[model samples]
Target chain A: MVKLLRSDFRRLWRSKLFYLGITAVAASVAFGLINNVHYKRIMLNLEIPIDNILFLGTLVIGFAIAIFTSFFVGTEYSDGTMRSKVVVGHNRSMIYLSHFLTTTFAAVFMMVIGTAVIVVVGIPWMGSFVTSCTILLPQILCCLLSIVALNAMILLLAMLIPSKAICAIVCLVLVMVMTNMISPTLWSKLEADPIIPEMSYTDSEGVVHTQPEQPNPHYATGTTRTILQLCYDMLPTAQMYQYGYDKIPKNIHLFPLYSVLFIGVLSTVGACAFRRRDLK
Target chain B: MEYVLTTSALSKKYRNFEALKDMTMHIPKGSIYGFVGRNGAGKTTLIRVICGLQEPTSGEYTLYGISNKDRRIAKSRHRMGAVVETPSIYLDMTAEDNLKQQALVLGLPSYERIPEILKLVGLENTGKKKARHFSLGMKQRLGIAVALIGNPDFIVLDEPINGLDPQGIVEVRELILKLNHEHGITVLISSHILGELSKLATHYGFIEKGHVVKEISAAELEAVCRRCIKVEVSDTKALIRVLDRMKKDYEVISDTQANIYGVVVLSELVLALAEEKCDLLASHEQDENLETYFINLVGGGENG
Candidate 1:
């Protein structure tokens, strides 16, 4: 397994996609910085948190990592290197795990580059951290873990699906739909109960009536809210969305735990599927 | 003789199609074993199963005397290397880098031998040229170089010379010979070109429709496919008696026909037949090549 990991890392280091992923992350960070500068100048009251910048930067970075991982792992099937590894006596579990680790490393590497860029440029542009170090540090850890969890999901897809083009399409679509649809929808559902504002109404006798603010029953509560929060904690994309908006959950530690669980489940399932797969 | 690999009633099925059925074969150590079969004749399927790329639906095989079901089979496979169908190589890496990756996979102590392995496959001068830019022949050689990283004793090559030009074919052929002869590495090569295989194989396994119809040594095959005189005689009983008395190897085809292996004197044969009151009807010289022998063994036709 150590040998397989070394070989996979060597190949990963030489892969053009790895460098491209880093470049994309760095460029997106610069773009984010420029946009923040423009927004700050135009609307002096608009304050962008460093956490938001780091988390949002990771969203784009996560997508870039997904694309990088899809092609990186996909080439094994396309070029028949996986079969070569198997033929040379490498265990299937080791092959799968090594690829997973290499991809995870690529994701983390890109995140590090993006985070560095954000801190260097973002600290000056957005002023010092609005949130204290105690809160910001944990959120940063959760955000990085979320990126790893997303990478694991993509790695699973890449390993199981044999075709490069199909794997790339599925991975891209998955990342988009998860972040754009499911995560945000769950987060929106879990938002605190809506506050209905006061309103005045005219009676038939020309008398005016005022109603005070009240909690909207239509908003999620009880079991529904609990389920939504649980889903938000479990979904990596939801974690990213929460961090992007600086709405760090009270149970922030659950994010890393969930990420670890996701990595375990995906790696287990991916290795089993890969073991049974018939290489063409 | 010690066999490097053996399959016992191995079978593989895909949905409704049976790729291999009750197939059994033996590859002797230190011999270039030619796997002769047409396209889709279970050649690659068998290779895939042995390489652990696909599992056998039934039965099992042993590598280096370790059964497939045994946990030690994984360790046993370290002695084996294969290039199934196409050369399994990373096209983005240079020749040396590809070899280094393989060495890493094999858990070698160091890559000091990579240079020697590259020179063995004639790719030492490839330098920084990535494999994707290499010609078909160079790519194939690089694949072989990767396989040779750990110095595996048993190598399986599937259609190694499939798409090569004449020069490339010669290079690959010579490389196979060098590996088998000087290195004493056992090789199992499958090829559609029988003539080229004939030059390399010391043994042959002729498979058709998911089963091996014939397995013969090069010497035995040479004897069977040797030039012979087909004689039509009036009496086989009398001819057999005479041929046996003269110590000749011959196969009695029917009551009136027999194939006399090796050279024969026509006057002596006629006189001997006459002595038994049998007359010679007709005679013709017959010589069979590997392709014709394979076609005949499989029952010649389009399907064959």
Candidate 2:
């Protein structure tokens, strides 16, 4: 397994796709920092803070991880190099585990580089974290775990799907859907308060009227709310949103556990399926 | 003779389709074993199972006396290498980098053999050229070079020459021969290209419908696939009478043609045929080749 890791990492360093991903991550973070500075000055209403920009790398790092994981593992299947590894006596379990380890390292490396760029540039532009740095450690750790869990799922798809093109397409589509639609939808529904607070408003007249509090129809209620909250907590992307944008997710303390469980479960399933899979 | 690889009732089934069923064969040490089969005839499937890319649905196989079920089979697999379907190479890396990656996989301590293997595969001067831009033949040779890195004594090549031009085919063919002869490596080549296989294989395993139809050495197959003289004459009756008088084994396939097996004294037979009023229009030697033998064994069809 160590040998396989060495080989895979060697290849990973040489892979153009991997480097391209790193570049994208670094640039995205750098651009986000620079854009924040511009937005702060241009839009006075935009309350952009260093805390918001602190883990901003977490949001876009998943995209880089997705592309790199797809091509990295997908190439093994597409180029049939994975078969060569097996042919030369490497155990399938070792091979699959090696891939998981190697890609995880790359994912972490990309995320770190993105974070470093943010830290280096973010402080100068938006000032230091308003919240205590140590107080933000839990969210920071959750962001890292979510990044890993997201990579684990993408790696799972890339390993199982043999066609490089198909695997790549599927991974990119999955990441886009999760980040754009599913995570945001879940966050909104989970964040909505069940009871609408009393509203005092002036509507087309100079007289103030107070509206009675009532059940918020859009808020997920009862069992549905429980399931939706669980999903929001479990999904790495949703967790990333909570960490990067939310002040502190209500489930901040439990997100890492969910991410770890997600990682453990997905890695086991991926390795087992990969071990039994037939290569052509 | 000792064998490098052996299988007993090994079967591989994918859902309802059986790629290999009770398939059994042997690859002798230091011999070029040609695995001949038609498309979808389980040639690649058998290779995949033995190479450990896929598990057998039932039955078992062995490498160098180590059973597939044994934990030590991986150690046995260390003595072998394979290039299944296409050349298993990272297209993004240069030829040298690819070999280095393979060496890392094998846990080899040095890159000392990289140059030698590249030279052997005739890719010594292809520096910094990524495999993706290499020609098909070059990629195939690079694959072989990668396999040759660990200095394994046995190698498996699945359809190694499937897409090569004539020149490319000859280059790969020569490489395989050199690997087996100079390095004394045993080669198990799975290919439907019988003509090409015939030129290289010292032993042959004919597979059909996931079954090993037969396993015979090249010499033994030569004796089995008899050489014959196909004669097209005006009167096969006269030809038959002359042949029978000469006590030759023959078969008359058509009204005007006959295949006289074994040796025939041409001038003496012509005189005898002339006396019998048999005018020989055409005569040619038909040495039953691998393709012919394969067709005859499995029955001729679109597969042939």
Winner by TM-score: 1
TM-score of chain A for each candidate?
0.89, 0.91
lDDT of 2 by residue, A250-277 (tens): 8788888999999999999998998878
Error of 2 at A51 (Å): 2.3
Show model 1 residue runs off by greater than 4 Å.
A47-52, A192-218, A221-223, B234-258, B262-278, B302-304
Question: What would the per-residue lDDT of candidate 1 be over residues B137-178, giving only the tens digit for each residue?
Answer: 998998888888888999999999998999999999999999
DockQ of each: 0.78, 0.71
* A1-280 per-residue lDDT for model 1 (tens digits): 9999999999888888889889998898788777766777567767666666666576686589768988998898988888888987788988888887888888988888888888888888677777788878877777888888888889888988888889999988888998889987886776655877888999999999999999887688779888888888888887887776646676688888988998789878888998888888
Q: Extract clashing residue pairs from model 2.
A: none
Name the candidate that leads on lDDT: 2
Residue pairs that clash (backbone atoms under 3 angstroms), model 1: none
